[model samples]
Target chain A: MELFAYPFMLRALAGALIIGLAAPALGIYLVQRRLSLIGDGIGHVALTGVGVGLLTNNSPVLTAVVVATIGAVGVELIRERGRTSGDLALALLFYGGIAGGVVLVGLSDDKGNSNLMQYLFGSLITTSPQDIVVIGGLAAAVLAAMLLLRPALFALCNDEEYARVSGLPVRTLNILLAVTTAVTVTIAMRTVGLLLVSALMVVPVAAAQQVTRGFRTTMAAAMLIGLASAGLGVVVSAEADTAPGATTVLMALVAFLGATIGGMIRRNLRRRHNRPPVTTEPPDVVLHG
Target chain B: MSMSVVEVRHLAAGYDGREILRDVSLSVSPGDVVAVLGANGSGKSTLIRTILGLVPLSRGEIELFGTPQPRFRQWARIGYVPQRLGAGSGVPATVGEVVASGRLARRGIFRLPGAADRTAVREALTDVGLLDRINDPVATLSGGQQQRTLIARALAGKPDLLVLDEPNAGVDAASQEAFAAALTRFAGNGGTIVLVLHELGPLRPLIGRTVVVHDGRIAHEGPPPEPAGHHAEPDHDHVHPHADEVKAGICEWAPTEGAKSY
Candidate 1:
């Protein structure tokens, strides 16, 4: 109860709750499309944006949103063109982004490496009022788009060619999804940190899928799982003196393990209960002349 | 005379820069079951893809329901069942959910699904004998069941022309029979169909016409070819000879200017 006593903890919890719900909501589509690592790629790109902001003495989150969005579009375009494999292109963008961040940050005279650490591993305690406001607005937009575009996005991710022949704007929607992913990455940076942000996007979905039979249920369960992992992880870390981002990700992994075991047990029980009556009989083979 | 349901003229299309199909022209009327037969890499899939606008034509035009492909916006009037399940194997989607997505074009993207959408989904599943497994994840279904789910997905749209790409490829005999039954019902309702098939199998009775693609050209178009006695085995691999090299040679004559002439 006293965990919410501190103003910074309260801010951290608020940011956590927003990202907890938004990341998995958008993440289910990425998981469906088999692009789970894309969030990590965008996260790497957001680091360069942070460096840009520090160098220009501007807000890092804003710059990160812009830079990461461009990176996301570039990656999506390359993947769409099919000239190169998706992972290969992401690797190129990933290395380029991190190296660019290091060079740009080294050139700046600000608080140097320590500031980047806050973005990389998350500094939930240092979340400013401005950070919360921006994160809230962007997260709300992401959630709204995910809800409004659920059918289209599901169809696109489910069967792109079918979606195309069905007269959906496949390319435009692809670009929009890429942009939405970019926004989600930047919005989650302060809460989960750039390095660990993708964990929130992916692990909960994996966990939820272990027990859920449908996409909608999986998405809903994933969000609830994500919310618990983030909110409770923050509280537990604050009490135990651990990193909130790492704690949150670890909690998600624990949930995934639990779900997997539970699912296995449930399947076993169902199989036993519904087992068909076996009939042992001699083979009646038909011989041809 | 009723307008042709589908009219493809001089369609030349391929992947990358290579021409896979050249001078492919076909027409289908309402209540017709046209089977497109060909060998692997013989451009049968490419032809279907070109008709669906999944592949860009190097030359020629495609008209669906009398409307040019670029201008044709009535997608709900045409249903499609791709060769394989398009959704990746990793994602979890119920049979009902995937079939429900087929109604998206009818309802538009912004609006939520109404009672009509739900009813269509249920009926489609029932048509495929998958109503019992509506809540089950598609991943749990066998290959045949998955293909049936795709058929149901297309049927839920209630299209006038159902286009299927190898609907029975790798499917079990029972699933094929189920698919044939569904197609028979669709045809009974006056639905037109254009399908790409490797082997006629149970569908031979339903195919009113056959168009054979050999080396990217329509080598034969008429009544279905009577498979020789040796090739009469069920599920036999069908391969037509490449003796049509002369025809292929003629098609390559103006390859350089193929796109410009369109």
Candidate 2:
């Protein structure tokens, strides 16, 4: 297909590969911690950031990064303030952010900016070299952070209180994690858009978790699943002339469902094969009621 | 002649605004096994929480190893096993990983585990009789096994003092015996222990002293009485059916006012 012949297509493919790898690495931790929706919440915040940047004639990526970072820190602060659940907090912030972005976009006089829709829903074919570089840098930083903080992340996922008691400086680690999430969400927004970014964040990890038992194995599986989804989604989009972002998310969804069903079937087969003979008497029989 | 490992002088602590423990005082010398006994809601857990620096002390002061409790760095010297191990459902971890986390305070934030840390973890697991099940997921373990894993986690730190809140609650008889034996070994090794317990039947013999807390205060404090063999019923005006063995040469008549029945 000579897909790499075009510079823009090459950049787009490289960007997708880098993001697909980094997102799941970060997403595995977020999903395990039940903060999968934080990506969606912060990505929506990035939309408002893009609108603000566009209105001000500034770089949208920079604005998005700044806004996403602020939004991530705000989310962590809100979580610390009260007993409100993380999902509820994310939902509230997401709605508020989308409303603000919608209002900002509507108020803008730039009616002829047809590319704005691409930013909203993603246009991988039109990805620039700058986007590729930004995504690559972000992916490298995220991978490094994940490698260095694997143990802390494990502690955070398993037992945060234990992490804190162990003198892990849990508050600082949490803030660092949120900052990484912000960067990942902001960069991934270029491929999956704001609303659909969480799908990419959660689906690969969910699918991987269904098949893998260990933490390292699950993370590896998730990264592989994400890369497959991104690559297949790009190819399908090219052949069928569809939106790459939506195609990628749909592919991830399919993988998730397939893995879930496969896991269930495997479990059922194992149960049947390992079944013991039935007992006439109950295992726990008390003399008195 | 060394100072007591932990000393709580007239400490009052609680959650949010309401006070749960009022003017409770206790001290634990090195190698002492002090049991804080009381009915539920009598502030036994609150006392442990206060000592561990989990709860704020509303009144009075606490000294750990002869130092005031405000210092954060010294927290590494103390170990804690909360009541609920494997808290709630969906806790995805193995017993070894959970126990290894106890060394976090000693390891600090940036550094990874060293050879010594792994050795301590292995020893702790062996001490708790969970060495064989190190790789088993904590959620899949029985209640007693989970508790032992928690104890192993605490022991991994090799703390000078171990504070446990209701470690024996809801544990099976076998696990209870194992836990008691572990505590005895810990005490023999010159490690101090402070625990909150309800139903001290299985643990009564191991405990050196019992401190009864009532209405957030220290109601009684003395060495636990020796285990008297099964006693025949004494003809008394008010005979309590549950009175099997008396301890400390003190017979406590059931309180008439605000006394909660077990």
Candidate 3:
């Protein structure tokens, strides 16, 4: 009751809950597509966007969305062309982003490093009302996009080559995933911070996949796990006066371990029941003629 | 209405920039079970990929059901079973769900599956003889069952033409029998098939015509090779010694071009 009493805490909870639903929803596609690390890449580029916003006295969220989107589309293009090897292109952009963010934040000495720290580690204690609206709006967009392209995205993630032959626009669908990933990363950066954002995107999904049998079920379960971890992380951190972002990611990790263990136990039980009792009635051995 | 399901003229296609199908021509008429056979890297796979519009053509034309490749959009009418992609891994897919995806090309992206889609999916599973295991994870099935799942997925779309690439490679005898039975049923319904194969094996009886690709060119095209006692025994070894012929064929292209001619 007291946790939700503070306005800032309420705002933070709203943002976290929205992200809890949105991140893993998009993360399922990324994980299925085998591009789980793309979230990390987009988050890194988003840091530079934050730096630009700080330097220009504008909305960091807006800037981060733009910069990260461009980064994602660029990554998809390079991946499509496959001219250069490795994640060289993404790694370069990532390094450049962190460096640029550090320089710009250092230059903008208005509120000292604490101003940047909030975005870096998340500031559930100071979440403004405007922040809640933007996070909610971004969350709505991501969910709407997922609903609109669910089928095509499922087939694309299931098998890219097969989807192409199925007459789904593979290139456009690819761009859709990239753009959504970027958007998910940008908004999520505010709640879990760019450093631990993927914890919300990927970890819960990993946990859900361990327990669920089919893709759709895994997706739904991941969202529930994500919401629980993120919400609990926010409330617990608020009450305990700790970093919400780190605590949230820790909760997700714990959930993943729990899911993995639960899944293993279930599978072992099934194996035991399915197996016939160790039989000793093997006396009908074939005799050489 | 063109009775031909597929037509390719002087097709040249390969990965990236290099070409694999040097100058291959192929045509398949409705109700024909045509098999494209060749050894590894012989470009039989490339030939089928080119025809399906998966692999880009450097030079040549492809027409499916009377429409040019670029203009064709009735993907629902064409069933495709790609080579050796066992049922999805990591995230599990049910035999039913995988079969349902086949309906996506037909059902479009705007809505969920209706009654017709569900019926099609169920019927496809039954066609593959996996109706009882419709809810089972596809990965739990053996190698052959997985291939049948892929075939059933294609069948769910009620495609008039089926293009299968090495559907039997790595498949077990039982699974192959199931697959053959499914194909037989499909053929009985007047479905045309263009299959790329290493060898006809279980499918030998169903094949009406055989086209062998060597060095990216059509090496032979005629009535299905008299099934060699070992396979029209005359078809593979008797008619064409696979090894010596491949050596001669590769040597013809290898010395002048290079290894992996694309």
- The model with the greatest TM-score is 1
Better of 1 and 2 by TM-score: 1
Considering only chain B, report the TM-score of each candidate against the true chain B. Answer: 0.86, 0.84, 0.85
TM-scores vs. true structure, each candidate: 0.91, 0.85, 0.89
Candidate 2 lDDT, tens digit per residue, A1-289? 5766888877777777777888888987787777777888888888788878777878777888898899999998887665547657778788877777776666666633465676678877777888788889888999889877777777776666666556566778788888998898888888877778778878998888766545666778889999999888877877788888899989988998998899778767766787752221112212321
Model 2 residue B196 CA deviation (Å) reads: 2.0
List the pairs of residues colliding in candidate 1. Answer: none
Most lDDT-accurate candidate: 1
Q: How would you order the candidates by TM-score, starting with the best?
A: 1, 3, 2
Q: Order of candidates by DockQ, top first?
A: 1, 3, 2
Give the Å error, residue A157, model 2.
3.1
Query: What C-alpha lDDT, on a 0 to 100 scale, does residue A23 get in candidate 2?
Result: 89
Which 10-residue window of candidate 3 chain A scores lowest in summed lDDT?
Answer: A278-287
Judging by DockQ, tell me the better candidate of 1 and 2. 1
C-alpha lDDT (0 to 100) for residue A196 of candidate 1: 91
Model 1 chain A worst lDDT run, 10 consecutive residues = A277-286
Please write out the lDDT profile of model 1 over residues B1-262, one tens digit for every residue.
Answer: 3889899999999988999998999999999999999999999989989999999889999999999998999999989899877745465788899999899988889889989999999989888777877887776665667788899999998999999999887665556777899999999899999999999988998999999999989999998877788688897776657536633443332222212211
> Once model 3 is optimally superposed onto the true structure by TM-score, how far is the C-alpha of residue B189 displaced, in angstroms?
1.2
Q: Judge the docking of candidate 2 as incorrect, acceptable, medium or high.
A: incorrect
Query: Which candidate wins on DockQ?
Result: 1
